[model samples]
Target: MPEAPPLATEHLTRVVDGQTLVADVSIEVRAEEVFVVFGPSGSGKSSLLRLLNRLDEPTGGTVYLDGTDYRTIDPRTLRRRVGWVPQRPTLIEGTVAENVAWGPTLRDEPVDEARLHELLDRLGLSGFADRDADRLSGGEAQRVAIARTLFNDPDVVLLDEPASSLDAAAADRVESLLADVMAAYALTAVLVTHDADRARRLGHRGVRLHDGGGVATGSLDALLSG
Candidate 1:
């Protein structure tokens, strides 16, 4: 039998502002696999991603990470174990290196310069270490955000529209970078995206959301073009 996936959600549900945002969602994300949540605006894609990493608690049901219930895990520890890259990259006023090192620093882990350099190179920010993170372009900053998330060496990465802010060319670059990073790190990834074509190009199974609930589960092509 195949090995179990790295992350799973069972009967997950969430409600906000007196309305349901996600309901009865269950899915598995395997190691080194890119699992994408696709939907239109306000369809609860981001909320679902947040639930996986425990950034948002479910109104009902549970999230499992590596076979453990996420809610039972300490928030700080769970967050460190599961990295998150938000839709809009928020950069602290600091050198790129400082921003990337922030996660490890918080965990009291000695900075791994080699790993830091490697991630920067892998994410195409090779010469950006000393540059101000606040000075980067949207695409560049998004890449830096990814690098920062990987710096902690988490088992899973949650990406909420990592490429949504980029132009067509830059978005393409972000997608390629994400694929490479996931493979190289053997990390489980859950991404929230609105672009159907980008979701197809990522070549991952997709979970579709509509009307604040999971509508279907299938290949990106089947779900998006259907």
Candidate 2:
């Protein structure tokens, strides 16, 4: 039998207050590749991502990580393996280093100072370790958020409109940085975005959501064109 894909969902659905946020969405993510979920605003892209890591319970169906059902794993453990980065960066009241090291710290694991610096360097924040997290610019804070997620060594990363709030140039930089880090770490990613060009640039295969359902699925180019 063929090895199962790194991440997948089967007939997943989520409804809130009798309103469906995601409906019967299913997709497979190949290892080390970027699988995109793209759609117009309020199309349930973010909702779908949240279910993958069980940030919200699915109303129906399930997600699989490495062929095993994700629901079987502990929520905290699942989150550690499947890191999430939201659209806007939310940093605690501390220095950049503190934020990046927060994950391992929670697990009572010793923070690897060297690894923290390496992640900062990779995210182009090499000398900002001691800087206050709250004081960074929008783009800078977002990069710090990405670094924080990577420091956990997750097998898969979920990014919800990661650059949506940035200026055009800053958005471009963040996207480029994302590609580099994913490649360098062999990380599988699921990115939610409304930008067709960004999808084409970053996604290998993707699905487009429309009103909480998957309207199209295939290679990024075909999905966007359809």
Candidate 3:
């Protein structure tokens, strides 16, 4: 039998403002694989990603990371293990290097300069270490956000519409960078996106979210072309 996935959700449900965002959704995400959540606007994709990282608590059910119930774990520690990149990139008021190093610094881990450089290079941001983050373009800022998340050495990365704001070329660059990162780090990734093509390119398995708390999981093409 195949090994169990690193992340699993069992009968997960979320209700906000008396609205049922997600209902009894179950998912298994294996290590070294990219799993994508695709849906139309307000279909609970972002809410689902938030649940995975504990950013948003589920109204009912459980999330397991590496076989441990996430509710039993500390949220901060869980966040450290599961990185998140939001839809809008928000950079601190500092140099690019500082922002990239913030997570490790907070954890009291000595910053690994070589790894930092490699991540920047991989994201096509080589030599941007000294640039002020506030001055970066939208796509560049997004890349820096991704670098910052990677700096934590998280085993799982959750990205919500990472490429939505970028131009075509920049979006493609982000996609390629994510693929490289997954291979290099052997990381499990779950991304929320509306772009079917992007999901097909990034994920082997796809989950589609719809109204009435319906979820269908299968091949990327099946979800996209449904």
lDDT of 2 by residue, 1-226 (tens): 9999889999999988999999999899999989999999999999999999999999999999999999899999899899999999999999999999989888899999998998898888999999999899999999999999989999899999999999999998899988888888888999999999999888899899999999888898889988
> Which portions of model 2 show Cα errors greater than 4 Å?
none
Candidate 3's C-alpha runs over 4 A off are: 212-214
Minimum summed lDDT over a 10-residue window in model 3 is located at 211-220
Select the stronger candidate by lDDT from 2 and 3.
2
**Residues 122-195 of candidate 1: C-alpha lDDT, one tens digit per residue:** 99989899999878988999999999998887888888988888898988898898788778887778878888
TM-scores for all candidates: the values are 0.94, 0.97, 0.95
Worst 10 residues of 2 by lDDT: 178-187
Evaluated against the true structure, the overall lDDT of model 2 is 0.93
Residue 193 error for model 3, in Å?
0.8
Could you tell me the TM-score of candidate 1? 0.94
> Which one is best on TM-score?
2
